[model samples]
Target: MAATLDQVRVPRARAGRPRTRPDRVLADKGYPSKANRAWLRTRGIAATIPERDDQIAHRVRRRRRT
Candidate 1:
């Protein structure tokens, strides 16, 4: 997904440089890994991907322990 995002080019409505980064990314659970999220954060891209079931469960367990 990161590789795909790197190749994105958003055409400008006016005469200007094309956008290299997108405003946001909407993806499914398959793209919700920690590395992917961190990469998007560093690049200032917003993600709307849902957490996987195991990730959610792990989060819940960790919260309960604290």
Candidate 2:
């Protein structure tokens, strides 16, 4: 996916290199793993995805115990 993003080209009016990286990435809960989120963060891209139900439940359970 990173490679694909790098290959993207957007024409500009002034004349310069095309846009390589996107400003943000929107994905579903299935794509919001720790590694995936870390990867997107490292690339300076914002990710807008909700946590999975299981993850949310686990967090809530843990919080209650503390």
Q: What digit string (tens of lDDT, one per residue) describes model 1 on residues 18-53? A: 999999999998999989999999999999999999
Candidate 2 residue-wise lDDT, 1-66, digit = tens = 456557767566688986766778788777878888888899898989899999999989999994
Task: For model 2, state the Cα shift of residue 40 in Å.
Answer: 0.9
For each candidate, the alpha-carbon lDDT, in order, equals: 0.93, 0.80
- TM-score of each predicted structure versus truth: 0.85, 0.74
What are the clashing pairs of model 2? none
Model 2 ranges off by over 4 Å: 1-15
> What TM-score would you give candidate 1 relative to the actual structure?
0.85
Worst lDDT 10-window in candidate 1: 57-66
